[model samples]
Target: MYGYIKGVVKKVYPSHVIVENNGIGYLIISPNPYEYKLDDEAIFYTYLHVREDVFSLYGFKSEKILNLFLKLISVSGIGPKSALGIVAFDDTDRIVQAIELGDVKYLTKFPGVGTKSAQQIILDLKGKLIDDEVEIKLISDAGKDVEAALVSLGYNKADIKRVMKHINVDQSADQALKEALAYLLK
Candidate 1:
């Protein structure tokens, strides 16, 4: 029922943070607890996960990531920790792209996702997570082509993602690849 919490960070831990709002402290499990600082004012978009005897409050820095986590947990073989590990290690855009493109190898790179789980993620989420028009317009097909080309050249996802931030999505794949290579070589 907690949509979000605006509070001062009271404590920071490896897997969670304690946010004190009003007079109570909330134990908020986060994918990246290091993102928060002690005593910093922050807003955490939250998800309350309730199971048989455990109640957990999972938190995300952004609503988009929170939504993606929700979608992940909906898959039969995926659970909260698996979903957290996925989002914690990869870019959300890349995750969506892998799902849409049915790239099982990329999905399996996540901590808890195996071959079967990766396939299930594609089966359950491809063509369903993002609208085609938004996907094409925002992260243009050309951009993805450039990313695939870079991956083929033995570059890691983190480096490719770093260069991608400098790429102009509107450009042709050839042009984008040239720009990305220039950035990578520097």
Candidate 2:
């Protein structure tokens, strides 16, 4: 039931960050740990996923992302990893919009989400965000090429997601490719 943790980042892995607080390091699984740097003091709005044998902490840099993750995990078939992957790939706002619009096709594009699950997401979450006043701003089509380029370069979707914050989808596909490559290589 811990709500948040403000600590210094001790390390950043591909899927999680180690945050140190009160001489204890908390391994918080995050969608994009690369957004944080070592030794930087920051606050993580968090959710602790607890089950019979599995206990893990998931943290987000922003409340919007945290809330979105919570909503995704609440769906019947979606787990924390699936929910994290969806948001990690920049599909939060898009998922919200798809659910709102009853766009099952768009919902199925997310990893681990099949037709049945997409329908469930739409059924469970549609009209949910409207009451919360969450805005939906999906990225442009250029993201496909950028994602493809990263995949072609042997970077998995999870790894590519860490660099997405630096990309601007307003540019052409080629530009997004180059920008994403530059960031990934660095």
lDDT of 2 by residue, 1-186 (tens): 878999999999998999999999999998888989899997999999899998999999788889988998898999998888888877456667667557788777778989998898878876575432322233457876777777787986566655554576668999988888888788
Reference-based lDDT, residue 48, model 1: 99
Could you say which candidate leads in TM-score?
A: 1
Candidate 1 positional error at 119, Å: 0.3
Taking the candidates one at a time, how many backbone clashes does each contain? 0, 0
For model 2, the stretches where C-alpha displacement exceeds 4 angstroms are 132-186
Give each model's whole-structure lDDT.
Answer: 0.87, 0.80
lDDT, model 2, position 32:
86
Clashing pairs in 1: none
Who wins the lDDT comparison? 1
